[model samples]
Target: MTKKIVVLGVSGSGKSLIGKNIAEKLGYRFFDGDDFHSTANVEKMSQGIPLTDDDRKDWLAALNKLLIDNPTAVIACSGLKPEYRAMLRQGLDDVAMVYLKGSIDTIWERHQKRDDHYFKGRGMLESQFATLIEPTEEEAFVIDIAQDADAVLNQALSLLSES
Candidate 1:
């Protein structure tokens, strides 16, 4: 079955790059979850501020709409909370989430080197990690962020194939 894979992680975890590669290899469409975030939300993050759950309500709803629209597109998102993931899963049975596990230090280093994004400099890392509800045993497959892009994508693809 062609399923929509939602890659979940905090910033600098390589969700976009790895997600696109996984989609390409799996013959699915790739949708960056950031694309679904509202401009004001992005602006808030750009200024090194954390967004409230109220801020994310529409964003999660948008993810649900995305799944409803595309049906089988692979998406990358910082689904940091169980409620957020539940929101995205509304009415979508075929959606599978891949939690990219990694350390804050590692991600902070990557964030320092990262360019062209509003989220950076360890500003939102604590909030994200604090909010993250790692997929339970019955929830989703958890893939560690390995060496590079391809390694991560390979692990995700393998998990998706198994699922």
Candidate 2:
């Protein structure tokens, strides 16, 4: 079966990095969910404005299409809420989610160092965490992000193998 893997977490949690690595290791295509965002949504986030569910509907739909287009792919996305995840899983039968779990402080530190991303500063990170509805262990392979990137990737690979 084709495996569609979503690397999910709050901003600065290493979703893009780890997801890309996972895709390389698995020989699958990699996609950043941020690239699926509409121009309006990007503009709002660029201005440090948090997006409402309505603002996210189109972006989520686009991500879902990406999944459909690349069945065996690794996608980096902030699948922060259950409903958001459900939207991504609309028609997929073999989807696996890897939640890059991390403490707020750790993620905040990383966020502070990032200069190129639109997800700006501690406030945006706080908003992301606030909106997050963490997935249960049964629902995802949760890998802690405190470790080095390679270590975290290894853990994710190990968990995916088991599943």
Candidate 3:
């Protein structure tokens, strides 16, 4: 059976990058949640400001809808809050979350090295990580990201295939 997998974490957690690989390995399409953000939201992030829950409501609703649309695929997003993950999973019973967890040092280093993006800046990532609530053991797969991409994708694909 096909699976709807969500790669989740704070900014710089490599969710999008690894989600793409995981999707490819699983032969599922990949959707980047950043693309679903509104222009205003993008502008706010470009300014290095965090989005309010109100600012995220519409975007989360859209993502939830898209999860419904693609019953079997992989998507990536900073699902920082438990509520946000729940929102994305709403109305999509087959959807599961995979958290790419890592240390502040690793994430901060990656964020600093990340180039050509509007979400670049220092310190704001602290808030993202602070806001993150890791998924429960049963919510989905949990894997540390120090492993190579191939290994991570192999494990993710295995889990997706089993589900």
Best by TM-score: 2
**What is each predicted model's overall lDDT from 0 to 1?**
0.83, 0.90, 0.82
Q: Report the lDDT tens digits of candidate 2 across residue range 1-163.
A: 2388999999899999999999999899999999988889888999999999999998888888888888588899999999999999888878899999999999988888888888766787889999999999988898889899999999999999876
- Model 2: worst 10 consecutive residues (lDDT sum): 116-125
Highest lDDT among the candidates is held by which one? 2
- Local accuracy of candidate 3 as per-residue lDDT tens digits, 56-83: 8899898888778875678898877889
| lDDT of prediction 2 | 0.90
Clashes of each: 0, 0, 0
**Per-residue lDDT value at 15 in model 2:** 95
Q: List the RMSD of every prediction in angstroms.
A: 1.3, 1.1, 1.4
As a whole number from 0 to 100, the lDDT of residue 151 in candidate 1 is 80
Better of 1 and 3 by TM-score: 1
- What digit string (tens of lDDT, one per residue) describes model 1 on residues 23-45? 88778888898888899999999
In candidate 2 the C-alpha lDDT for residue 39 amounts to 88
lDDT of 3 at 34: 92
Comparing 1 with 2 on lDDT, the higher-scoring candidate is: 2
Candidate 3 — worst ten consecutive residues by lDDT sum?
A: 120-129
How close is every model to the real structure, measured as TM-score? Answer: 0.94, 0.96, 0.93
User: What C-alpha lDDT, on a 0 to 100 scale, does residue 59 get in candidate 1?
Assistant: 90
